[model samples]
Target: MSVYHRPVSNIWWLKRKPYILFMIRELTSVFVAGYCIFLLVLVYKLTQGADAYGNFMVALKLPSSVALHLISLAFVLYHTITWFNLTPKILVLYRGEERIHQGLVAGTFYAVWAVISFMVVWLVLGV
Candidate 1:
């Protein structure tokens, strides 16, 4: 049989985008890890005494670091939303018909997040 194939298009990431996106998402954690390391250093500096803590704070307040933080926060927010959106798929609990229960799955995920948030605020505010 003679072959007849269409040209591949840029929009056709159906086959590649998932892997590409997964790699992008995977690498994005570098910023998250870096943030944690920075926090740990801050903690260490605080324990070392006030002067060290002040120096750490001043270093963090540098313009370049401030910009890095803003960008990392944006990346983190995007990562969190995308990650939580996929939580329902992994949690995979059902309450009704498959299509109808999808809402339940999503709702439950958000509900848990809300509860955890409440607990966090209560702890932080000493309520």
Candidate 2:
């Protein structure tokens, strides 16, 4: 019987730009999940009555919370951008004899995302 051992370095992903970006994209999920949980808590607070919701808003207004939210927003934006860029690879489009350009596919995704996001904001604000 023969035993083989392999060692993995902590900064292995650092060896390549793509690998680092991939790791960052994977880690962005944690921040996204955290933001989702934060929203859920806000919803729970709303259910608890106006006072609870007010308190939660106040807590969120704190500097630390603001910082966390900003950091989370950055991660979410990066995650979204990477996913949008990868869409062409995940979804193939053909124009009869030729395939659509990757940039066009990604641009379409961004346009739709922006439109939907704007609609959501408008609906939420009633403005």
Candidate 2 ranges with C-alpha deviation above 4 Å: 1-6
Assess every candidate by TM-score. 0.66, 0.89
Q: Candidate 2, residues 1-127: lDDT per residue as tens digits?
A: 9998889999999999999989999999999999999989988998999998999988988999999999999999999999999999989999998999999999999999999999999998989
RMSD of each: 5.0, 2.3
Report, for every candidate in turn, its global Cα lDDT versus the true structure: 0.78, 0.95
Residue 5 lDDT, candidate 2, scale 0-100? 88
Give lDDT tens digits, candidate 1, residues 17-45.
78677766766798899899988988899
lDDT of 2 at 79: 95
Model 2 / residue 61 / CA error / Å: 1.6
